[model samples]
Target: MKNRVSRWLNNEQHLAYSILIPGCALVLVFAYLPAIQSLRFSFLRYNIKMPGAVKFIGLENYQKILADAVFWQTVGRVIYFMTVGGLLVMLLALGMALVLNQEFPGRALLRTLVILPWAIPPVVNGFLWKWILNGDYGALNGLLYQLGLIQEYQFWMANALAALSFAVMTFVWRYTPFITILFLGVLQSIPGELYEQATVDGAGALRRFWYITLPMLSNVGAIAIILTLIAAFTVFDDIVTLTGSYPTFYDATKTPMIYNYEMTFGMGRFGRGSAMAYLIGLLLFALTFFYIRMSLKKED
Candidate 1:
């Protein structure tokens, strides 16, 4: 038995399988199993409140979702939110990465400070920004008023546009630092000799950045953009904390996750909610698949 076990462990393929088995089992149990169950639930008329009414309803839940005007509107709103928020986050992160990549006094301390916001839990970040943007007694309004930019405290969340903007701003603030760190590492990996050679050829700062920096960071930027796109679409805690449970703002600020939550818990429509969840997952999967394919094609 000992000789047989030793030979098995010595075989590379067997060893590889042994190492992978646990992780694969864990993923199967934790991730894929729940997803399969959710897909099953999506086709049934199961409600937490009405457990006795559980019945297989085929694609009726999905049909209702597709035919709902509000669902389409929410889809549009989420797309808008993802676009604006993702762009801002990527830009801000790239800017920070450039600045932090340079030598400066107290650069280490500055880098630490830059990462502080990203380290905060999403729920905490949401609550912190919510307090800062509060309409009647917000610190932002007070500061602007003090600076003479505003005559009085502005209700930031009362207006749909302002609320959406605030939500995006909070998201950018929280997520930018992580992307910054990612880009910073990429920047550091780029040999300084490239910049030095560019300078020797009489390249100015902007020219060096345009040529050397952008090209080197292209792959990293693509990955970062894809990640930010995913995060923006799936955002939930930030919206919940920023907007609370107000029904009035649902039309303006609801993303797919928020809509799913409201349907599942708020209205006790588990079947429809599951259907929406799977639909959103499918959309994300398609987006990611196409993006990865495009990136691979570009590489080729």
Candidate 2:
């Protein structure tokens, strides 16, 4: 038995299975199992209010989600948020990365400072911005007043448009540093000889960046875009901290995640909530799949 066990452990296939088994088990337990459970729950009538009425009503929950005007509105808002906020984050990160990639007096210190925001927890970042943007006693209002930009303290959160803009700004601020780090690493990996050769051929700064740097960073950029896209779609803690789930404010800042939370915990409609969650997951998966396919096609 000892000889047989030793032989099995030495076998490459067995060793590989032993190494992968733990990780596979973790994924199965934490991801696949919960997802399957949620999908199952989505088909039932599982409201906390109606405790004894736990019947399987096939597609009813999905039907409600599809027909709900508020749900559709939330979907539109989330799409808008992802588009505007994701672009801003990527652009700002790229710009910052370019600046930081250069030789400077305090380049190291500046890089550290740039990454500080990304290190902050999402909920904490949200609360910090919430205070800064507070209408009556906000630092922003005081600064604007001092600058003579406004005669009075403005209620930034009271206005729906302003609130949405601020939320997007907060998302961009928190995530930009991470993207910057990603791009910076990619930028550093690029061969310096390419830029030197470009300069020898009379290439200016803008032309060098456009022709050489951008093309080299294309794969990294695509990956960053997909990551930011996923993060934007599943955003929750920041929105919750910045804007509490007030029904009045729902029209402006209600993301799909927020809507799911409101339904599942706030209203105790587990079935409907599960359905919405699945729908969002499906949409996200489809979008990511489409992007990956397009990217692969281009590569081919």
User: Which numbered prediction scores highest in lDDT against the true structure?
Assistant: 2
Q: Report lDDT (CA) for all predictions.
A: 0.88, 0.89
lDDT of 1 at 194: 91
Worst ten in a row by lDDT for model 2: 243-252
lDDT of 2 by residue, 13-98 (tens): 99899999999999999999998988998999999888999999999999999999989888888888889999999999999999
Each prediction's TM-score versus the true structure: 0.89, 0.89
lDDT of 1: 0.88
Residue-level lDDT of model 1, residues 105-129, one tens digit each, is 9999999999999899989988898
Q: Per-prediction count of colliding residue pairs?
A: 0, 0
C-alpha RMSD for every candidate? 2.7, 2.6
In model 1, what are the clashing residue pairs, if there are any?
A: none
